[model samples]
Target: MNSAFLFGLLGWLDLFGIAVFATSGALAAARKGQTLVTFAFFALVTGVGGGTVRDLLIGAPVFWVQDSRVPILCLAIALIIWVTPVRIWRAGAVDWFDAMGLAAYSVFGAAKAMQLGIDPVPAAIMGIITACVGGVIRDLLAGEPSIIIRPELYVTAGALSAFSFVALMQTGMDGIVAAAIAFAAGFALRALAIVKGLALPVYRGAAEDE
Candidate 1:
């Protein structure tokens, strides 16, 4: 595949992640019967929070600030959610959308870090950050429990995508192929966790009173 075309494809994946994450954020506000302004605020913060942190940590320019389109897209999504009927969101819709964002963002984040000459380990870490920080911010702002404190697989899924992308790229596989496989793996894991209630084994060390 052409490098420019590959870059464009990756760009689309980034936008896909942003849109879903933003939707989840908007849905959060909607659930609370919030105003359009609040919807937009939640959407913008959750949409760019992760990417902003990633860029800052990687010493790259903040993406949304550099590209007006990012914030505009977020606002547009918020407006859509604001105007749409609550029935559209349905039960568990937010989790599904979040799963999609987590997968795509994880792969895109790792890929971007690799492109920027970051080492594989840190690049993978950037992927996790990209996939998670936004939701963390959203939950905190909404007064919900942090995803990190939950038992179901969430960050683990993101790590699968990020580390898988890095490992695949290290083997000289095509970026597109690597990204697809990684994204699928992450999403599948999260989906299973959502559907089957799969979770990592929690600590069973010493007794609290010990």
Candidate 2:
């Protein structure tokens, strides 16, 4: 796709990513019997945490701050979950939502970095960082073990998508097409991990070799 088309796609994806992440954050709080303030805090932090860090590292203004609607959207999501019946969310919805957000944000991060004149390799790294850090922060705040410590293929899923997006875009693939494939591939991998217990090989270091 052309630059305009790519940028337009990125914009929409960015909004959707924020919404999905915010919902997941709010739902996580729901499981904890949190107050409205905690719900909003979790949603806002989980929604904007990674993108905000990515922007700052890239010398761009933090995204949620630049766009007033971002935080408002996060809060709105939190409110929706807070007012709704807890059972309406279903079990493991947060994990599924987070999986999709990871894929979307990975692509978005790479695209944003590329637009900022960053090289493809670093751009892909930015994608992984963007996909994973928000969840890390969210888990820390929730007093849960982060996914990175889990045996499942989490960050690896992000890496696969980010790398694929960067490679495909460099090979002249349409941006939207690249994003679709990359996001699907990543999400599929994560879904497999969720459904089939797929995971990376364990590292048996010298300490464990004995």
Candidate 3:
């Protein structure tokens, strides 16, 4: 893939991920009956938290600080959610939006890392971090159980997306093709987990009292 084109694509994907993640965060605040200030705070933090960490780890500029549009976008999303009727949002809206963000961010993170000359395994790990860390922070701030702590397919879905994208890129596939497939696979897995209550197998060690 052309480096410029790949970076540009990643930029757009980053925005998409940020938008959905912000929405999820705003929804979290709305669910808790928080004020607009709280909603904006949650949106901004959740939207940029993972990306900020990823950039710092990879020696890149923190994205939201450099991009004026990022904070504005997050605040705008929070305002929209605040004014909208809670009834308009479907049940589990936060999870659905998080799922969308997770898939897109995972691909973007892996691609960006590889473009910056990172190795494949580390790039995939970066992808998972980008996808999941934001939601984890949001859950903690909201006083909810972190999804990563559950048996759900949250991080597993992100791993599938990131690893699949990296694997396809390794084969010289088009970036768009790899991204689409990876995002779809990840989102589908997460959606199935939401709809079907699917879970990873739990560890079954000997009882502590035994």
Lowest-scoring 10 consecutive residues by lDDT in candidate 3? 201-210
Best by lDDT: 3
Q: For residues 1-210, write the lDDT of model 2, one tens digit per residue.
A: 378845699999988888888888888899888999999999999889889889988888788888989999999999999999987877899899999999999999988999888999999999988888888888888888997888988999999999999999999998889999999999999999988888888877976878
Question: Better model by lDDT, 1 or 3?
Answer: 3
| Candidate 1 lDDT, 170-200, residue by residue in tens | 8888888889999999999999999998899
Per-residue lDDT, model 3, residue 30, is 96
Model 3 reaches what TM-score against the true structure?
Answer: 0.97
> Residue by residue across 60-142, what tens digits does model 3's lDDT show?
98888999999999999999999998999997999999999999999999988888899999999999999999999999999
Clash pairs (backbone) in predicted model 3: none
